[model samples]
Target: MSLRTVAVLLADQAAVFEFGVLHEVFGIDRTAQGVPAFDLRVCAEHPERPVNLLNGLSLNVPHGLEGLLGADLVAVPATELREFSPALLTALRDAHDAGAIVLSVCSGAFLLGAAGLLDGRECSAHWMNTVDLAAAYPLARVNGDVLFVDEGDIITSAGTAAGIDACLHLVRRELGATVATTIARRMVVPPQRDGGQRQFVDMPIPECTGDSLRDVLQWMSEHLETEQSVASLARRASMSERTFARRFVAEAGTTPAKWLVLQRVGRARELLEGSNLGIDQVASRSGFGSAALLRHHFTRTVGVPPSDYRRSFSRALSA
Candidate 1:
């Protein structure tokens, strides 16, 4: 069954970005992209009450808890970390019991945790909160590295932009890849990024020093179609191979080979979304060397093959 009705619960100190993420995904009209609009409603504890936001702004929510009664999906955006009232918790549980999908963005997982929906489920949240989430709910396995977790009816996402990925993933699963891709194109974001992709927070790269390899990085991006090796890169940066390797990790937050693969995948995604190039041509241009290699890495990284990606996202005019 497809999701049609969505209810986003509001609380005191709600985050504008996370709330906006939900609205951007399910609350807008996208008939131009061939995607159907959802019956979207925003709910708060008090109807017609002005709810305070984290940024000092306030929203006058028109719907109360009654708005959640028949929603096909119930979403909770990030809010201040605190326990919800018994009534709100019961509503969340009742919605899940009624077969509605339950979703949380960022620290909103804490609300689900409070509602006892996360017990014994593999879930996640923003990395900054994963430690506390795990400590509070030891039965729930909280993986901080992933962008989101989809445990059947319950889905949770990491901080900020990760909510977009999780929301689009649900759209793809329920609607179809065509709809998901079209919506993604309209939003001007990559159609999909696998949940397991790193949050890009493990290593912090400091601002460039005088000897930074900014020029070398730009050169590599431009020459991705050609071969790249540690020896060649070290020569271009005028450093020893060992020093280059060390500095590359210090500056880029990843090893050279891993960084190169990520860049290649990004380029391939652009070609798949915006160009009419065949699979082999895309592989050649993205520095994958062969279609088989591209398929292996792209599938591992994107959770889909190149042709399937193109079918989902290739523009109609280009196709």
Candidate 2:
């Protein structure tokens, strides 16, 4: 099979780390194990311009935006400038119009927004720039909490390392878990992280005591099938509901109810992927109460119906 082409757009004062991530994932040839490798090119707006990098080093890009036409995937690394050049935006718009996957790392989403690509799409950028991105592009649904957003043809990630997560996720969605896992193992990073997680959280260290909320969290995970509520858990922990809620959020980085729902949905996904159980049985085991409830939250969180996810994974396992 022919190789896929990926183009990385370079600009002045580029973010070196984000550029490195694009190079690491798509620039390198990883076809020794029959994995499809990308044909990578670093293109600039002007072929002979000296590009100033974050470090003292400079680079001269040989190809200009014309290279974007040959790319199956086009990446725009983060930049220090809040606004992008009008010419660069036009090139990106043309690439997207021709059916290429346009991706952004960190503040690169700002470029996509400036190019009018994010007008009706949900996108993510660095959490620190969330306010500015929102104010600048009121038409875009800019989510700050997630690591990334994969809108099929257009993907955007939050900060530096989140670029790795977004790329791995695209690999998984396009290839499969096996290929994504292999790539992640080679890169020495976690294979998967749900996109809904907070970009950063100040996890409080648990007090060294026999009575701690950490123990309660473990217990809750162990007994997910049972009815769990904030008041009931607080009573079992021997603390007032208000204090328990505060401590839970401080330690866990999310509300107790939201956390419980996430855990339940996670369990449901596992059962759906690994078992041939009916929807009702999967729902009961995952503590979703009923199949209707399972369908509602599963589609809301996972972005697909439970039946579809099950069928896709089941086919993969069989193959």
- TM-score, one value per model: 0.66, 0.64
What does the lDDT read for residue 143 in candidate 1? 90
Model 1 scores a TM of 0.66
Write model 1 residue lDDT over 1-319, tens digit each, in one string.
6689999998888899999999999988987768888999899887666989897899988788888988999999998857788888888898888888999999999999999999999998988999999998888989998889999799999999999999999999999999999988888888998887656463332333434888888898889998999999999999999999999988877888888887888899889989888889999999999999999998877666888777756784344
Q: Could you tell me which 10 consecutive residues in candidate 1 have the lowest summed lDDT?
A: 202-211
lDDT of 2 by residue, 217-253 (tens): 8888778799998899999889999999988887777
Q: Locate the minimum summed-lDDT window of 10 residues in model 2.
A: 201-210
lDDT at position 40, candidate 2: 86
Against the true structure, whose TM-score is highest? 1
Candidate 1 lDDT (Cα, 0 to 1): 0.87
